[model samples]
Every structure is written in C-alpha cells, then in structure tokens.
Target: MRPFAVNRIPRWISGAVLVLWAFCVVYPVFWSIMGSLKDNQQFFNGKAWALPKFPLLWSNFSYTWETYHFGRYFVNSIVVTVGSMALALLLSATTGYVLARYTFKGSGLLYYFYISSLMIPAILTLVPMFFLFDTLHLTNSLTGLILLYAIGALPFGIFVIMGFFKSLPRELSESATMDGASHYGVFLRIMLPLAMPGLITVSIVNALSFWNEYPLALILMNDPGRYTLPVGLAVMQGEMQYRTEWGPLFAGLFISMVPILLLYAIFQSRINEGLVAGAVK
Candidate 1:
C-alpha cells in the first residue's frame, strides 16, 4: 500500500482561508477594545487604526458605568438573562424528555408544533404580544421581559434537547425503571446528567441571545432605570449626537460583549460535543 502524501497547495489554501476568517472576527473586537482605551479625539481623528494614546483613559468605563447608569443596566441584563435561561432550560428539558420518550396520542403533534414555531418570525407577534402583556399588566416589568425571553428561546432549546434525549439508549431508562426508579427519578438522576452537553450548548446560545436582545427589551422596559444593556447602549449612542464621547461609548459596547465572549470560551468544548452528538445521532 502506498503511504498518503501531504497536499501542500490545498493545505496552504486552507491555512490562508482560516487566517483570513480569524482576522475578520478578531480585528473588530481588538479595535473596539483599543478604542475604549482612548479619548474621543483619538477615536475620531482618523486614528482608529492607530496606536492608542499614552496614559490610556481607562476611566471611560467608569464614566459609562456611573454617569450613564450602565451599572444598573448591566445588573438588569444579568438578572433577565439568568432568570430566563433557567426557566428555558427547565421547560425545554421536561418537554423534550416527554416528547422523546413517550408515545402519547398528541405527543407528535405537540413536538411538531414546537418545530413549526421556529419558522414564524418573532416580529409578526410583536403587536399581539404587546397587547397581551398590556392586558396582563406585565409591560414595563423585568419579569415580563424574562418570561418573553424564556418563551422565545423554548422552541430551539426543545429541538436541541429532544435530539439528545432521543439519542440515548432505551436501556438506560428501562434499567432505571427496573430498579424501581420513578419516571421523575429516572429523568432527574439518570437522563438529565447524560444530556449535560446539550443543556450547556442551549444555555450558552440562549444566554447570548438574551444578553444581546434589544427590541423586546426596549419596548417592555419603559423606565430608564429598568433598561437592559443593549437599550442603555442605544440610549448612550443617541446621547453621542450632542457630545461625541466615542471612547466611553465603545467601552460600554465592549463591556456588553465580554460576558458572551467569556461564556463561549468556557463552554466551547461542550458546544462542539453537542454539535457533533446532534450530527452523529
């Protein structure tokens, strides 16, 4: 048998493509970080690509946090994202487990309904949702925003988790049941742990979406003090029309992205695992 030989040209081409893609992703984030360290003059004086000025203005972050109430907005974002993600995971896991394991008459119908919802554009529901929330006296409330975020994430979460649950061997549940484990016990103890990769993947995806969500948050949170980070950033940009504090604005934007970056970095391995699992199974 002949040994395989390296394809140098194709390898070089692939390397170049990857390098370009990395640059495209990294440069904007790098620029934003550097911009946040400089003052407005440096940011606007066609020096965005230039080295930041000496004595970096790290105070820009503080100004953004204190003057613009970015701290409050940041807290609000954390609360909403965490709360919504927790609710979404619980609901999706339970629903996905039942759909994957059971043979009830309407189970297939319900699963398809969730799958179909992914096709419906969320914007189409805005007006009706607004009226519904208003009628429920939930508009302008963090709880309302949290509920909306969780519900919005449910379809995708269920889809992902259902695949994982279905991929597991039937013997696992059967053995647990033979040992006198209740359905709830089999799920909570045996199945949920096995589904960790999918849960982590869904959590990261939903967290990023909830963290960066702007439109629904803007409409729901009327009080300035209740605004999430994205809405606060928009308000900050609007203020920039009068006074161009580009540095601090970029600082706020950079801050907004850090949590998501950190989240992906931490769960990146599980993300890959979940994707591969879904694909293979």
Candidate 2:
C-alpha cells in the first residue's frame, strides 16, 4: 500500500477556521471600542471595519457618564449585584452543606424538588413574583430588586455548590468532630474555607446575572435614579429614532462590560478550579 498522509486537508484551512472563530468572539468588543472614538458623522459615513481617524475618548466617556448618569446606574448595579450575590451565597452554601453533610429523611426528595425549580422558565413566575413584591411594597426599591435577583439565582447557585460540597471529603469533618468542633464550627472553619472557590464561582455567576437583569428591574424599579446599566442604556434610544451617537453609546456599553470582564479575568482560575473539582468527584 502507498504511504497515506494522515492529515490530508490544508493546514491553512484549519488556521483560517480558528481565525474566524477568534474574530467572531472578539470583533464585537473591538468594534465597540472603535465606535466609542468615532463622531456621529464618521460612525455612519466611515466604514464599520475601519478604525477612527480621530479618537475622542475623553469626550465620549464624559458624555456617556454625564448624559446617561451612568455613575448612578453603575453604583446601583454594584449594590444590586453585591447584595444579591451575598444573599445567594449564604442560601446556597447553607443548602449545599445540609444536603451534602447530612442523611435525613426526604433529603433526596428535597434536593430533587429544589433542582426541579430550575426547569421552569423565570418569565412564567414574573406575574406572581410581581404581585407578591407589589403586595409587600417592594416595588421600585433596590432591596426588592436584590431580593428578586437572589431568588432567581438561588436554584443554580444551590446546584453548583451542592456538587462542590458533595465532592468534599467527609474525613475532614470527621477530624473536626473528633476535635470537639460542632456542626456549625466545622462548616464555618473547615468546609467554608475549603469551598471558597465554589462560593466565589456562585458569587460571580449571581453578580453577572443580577448586573444584566432587565425584565424584573424594569417592572420593579420605575425610578430612573434606581435603574441598572441595562435599563439605563435601553432608555438612551429616542422615540424609534436611530441616532448615530455611536461614540457615547459604545462608551457606555464598553464601560458597563468592564467590571464583569475584570472580575472574570481576576478570578478565572478559581472558577476553573471549582469546575474541575466538581467534575472530578
């Protein structure tokens, strides 16, 4: 038999495919950054593929911050994201710990019931949620938004943290118990520290979800001052008119994305570690 080339396809074709994938992922970020430097005239008249001839970053950033009152929106987003994540972490950590460490009647049934909630579409519950929140006068408040976000985030956080907690060694807790540590002490000093990566992962996931939340925020918060970034940005459009104010719009969007991106960059290793830890055991 003649010698066969195992790789028959051209290397350049594979390279081209990889390049295309990379471009697909990064092109939007690049375009947004470039658009933030272009004037209204240049944004439309100039080629979208081309970079700005004159970068007006300072003016664009200033306009986006001032006109959109993005500072206030940013603070609101931070508060909501942080508060929701805190609540999510607390609830998830406790739930996961209980499910993992104990063997009680109906434990499996309870876990199944909790996980089943994730199957239902969040939009389906919006009416009931809104009615409940309205009844409590939680409508149009930051606390209401945080509470709503935390509730929505709970299922996934509990699921993810449950996997991590289940993967943990029971021997550690056994040792803690031998040393006379109580259930609360073992959880607080041992389990929690060991599960830090999972907690951080839950926090990041909940924060991102809360930051990008719109539908609930739209219904709950009527005040413009309490608007998160997504809501504030949506209001920037004027009466079905497509204004070519790409500079400020892009600047606002770019700024809005920075915190989450930075967070992912900083804690990416921990996220990966938690994922691998969960997957292995």
Candidate 3:
C-alpha cells in the first residue's frame, strides 16, 4: 500500500522486536509455572528454561497454602481489595459528580486540593499514619486498611471519574430532571450507568493497587494472622535465608498473581476506552 508497508526489512525488524518483547514478558511466567512443579535439585540442576519433568510436584502449592496459610492471606487480600474498590468507587463517583457538575464557592479549590494531595507521596505520611493508626486502634485491622486504601485511592479516582462526569452532556441530566427524576435518581440511573467504562476502569485501578499494595499493608498490619497476600509473600521471601523452598515460593507468587492478572486481562479494553473517552470528552 505504501513504501513503509511494503518494506520487508522494516517489517521483519518490527516483528523481531515484538517477538523478543513477548518472550521477555512470557518467559518469567512460564518459568515460574515450570519451577512451581520442580524440587530444588531439579530446578537448579536441570536447564533453567526446561519444563518440569514428569511426576510434577503439585505439593508445592499445597505446602504453601497450608504451611504458610496462603489461603488466609488470599481471603484477606480479596476482602481488602473488594472493600476498598467498592468504597472508593461510591465516594469517588459522588464526589466527582458533584465537583464536575456543580460549581459553587471553593469547588475549584476542593478539586485542586485533591490534585495537590495526589502529587504528595504516600511515603511521607507513613510515620504520621503509623501513630494515627495506633491512636485509633486501627493497626492490624483489615477494615481499617480498607478505609485507608479507599481514601488513598480517592484522589486518583476522583481525578479520573470527575473527567468522565465532566465529559457527560448536561442535557441527559436536565431531561431526566424534567421527567421528575430526583438528583439521586438521575445520578444512579442515568449518569452512573453511562459511566460504566470509567467505573470499570477505576475499579480495576483500585483493585490492582489494593491487591498488590505492600508498604502500607506491611506497616499497618502487625499481626501475622492479618497479613494480606503481598505481605504474606514478603514474609515467605524473608524465610528464604533460613529455608530456601524455591517451589513453594514460586507457587505463592503464582497464587498471588492469578486474580490481578485475570482482572486486567478481562477489563483492559475498558481501561483504554475509558481513558480515551475521558480525554476526548
């Protein structure tokens, strides 16, 4: 069709680059799966890239699940992630709608406050949060982490969801109002559903953040029983100095990876759609 399109060398080079990138991304996951089925000796002695031999060790998963209580950690992660996403979405949707649709005194200032807060690093507040959590008896509390995660994600959520709201035509709201829809009805029935792509995008963002969150969870959760998956993985890694259970370690990692990977894979298109709509509108 064109010089660039017909150029075989460039096409070949581009294909090569893509293949290399794909391999780089895929190999680690492949290796991890293979490694999860191997003993320490097989993992070390066999070719690093080789698939596990027959009689694959499924015991690694069982051992990690039972011994490390990864099942507990998995449940904890799900609770925190789902709770945080739900809370954050509700709060962000309401706040973003109000900020985006209604203009009153200090509205701009309020939006800017969130913008500025988003820029502030989370690490800077860790010391303050530690003391505050202790004072409030929130340490090692999953509910407390849910609230914190929701609040921590609020700024970004508001930023994204607010754009979605702003992009929506006011005619939809005005017409719904003319039909005797209350403000809440208009928002719930009309505006919210219209913003589904944005909501999915925001949920995915918060889901990933809360699921993989490390430093905050690590610092706030003191009780081993309360550990989220990331913290649990860290605890597992820490045991490596004393016990190098490579199989179980990879199994733990793979377990932690599954939900987030599946989530992203399913909703990734929505993310792109929402972002593009937000930008365009």
- Candidate 3 local Cα displacement, residue 110, angstroms: 0.8
RMSD after Cα superposition, model 1 = 2.7
Clashing pairs in 3: none
Give lDDT tens digits, candidate 1, residues 1-281. Answer: 66668698997999999999999999999999998889877866855599788899999999998998999999999999999999999999999999999999999899889888878998888888888889999988899999999999888888889988999999999999999999999999999999887898888878878999988887778899899999999999999889889889989998898898898798888766554544452
Off by over 4 Å in 2: 1-5, 238-244, 269-281
Q: Which scores better on lDDT, 1 or 3?
A: 3
Candidate lDDT scores, in order, read 0.89, 0.82, 0.90
- Lowest summed lDDT across 10 adjacent residues in model 3 is found at 272-281
**Which numbered prediction scores highest in TM-score against the true structure?**
3
Where does candidate 2 have its weakest 10-residue lDDT segment?
Answer: 272-281
Model 1 ranges off by over 4 Å: 1-17, 44-46, 272-281
Ranking by TM-score: 3, 1, 2
CA-RMSD of model 3: 2.2
Question: What lDDT tens digits, residue by residue, belong to model 2 across residues 1-281?
Answer: 77856465775688899999999999999999888888878867888888888545568888889877988899999999999889888888898889988989998998888878877998887789889888999887999888878878776777888877888998999999999999999999999999887788778766766888888887777788998999888877552166557788888888789998897798887656654543453
Give lDDT tens digits, candidate 3, residues 1-281: 54554578888998999999999999999889888998999877988888888799999999999999999999999999999999999999999999999999999999999877866899999999999999999999999999999999888889889988889999999999999999899999999999887888988877888999999999999999999999999999999999889999999999999997898788888766655543442
Enumerate clash totals for all models, in the order shown. Answer: 0, 0, 0
Candidate 3: misplaced stretches above 4 Å? 5-8, 273-281
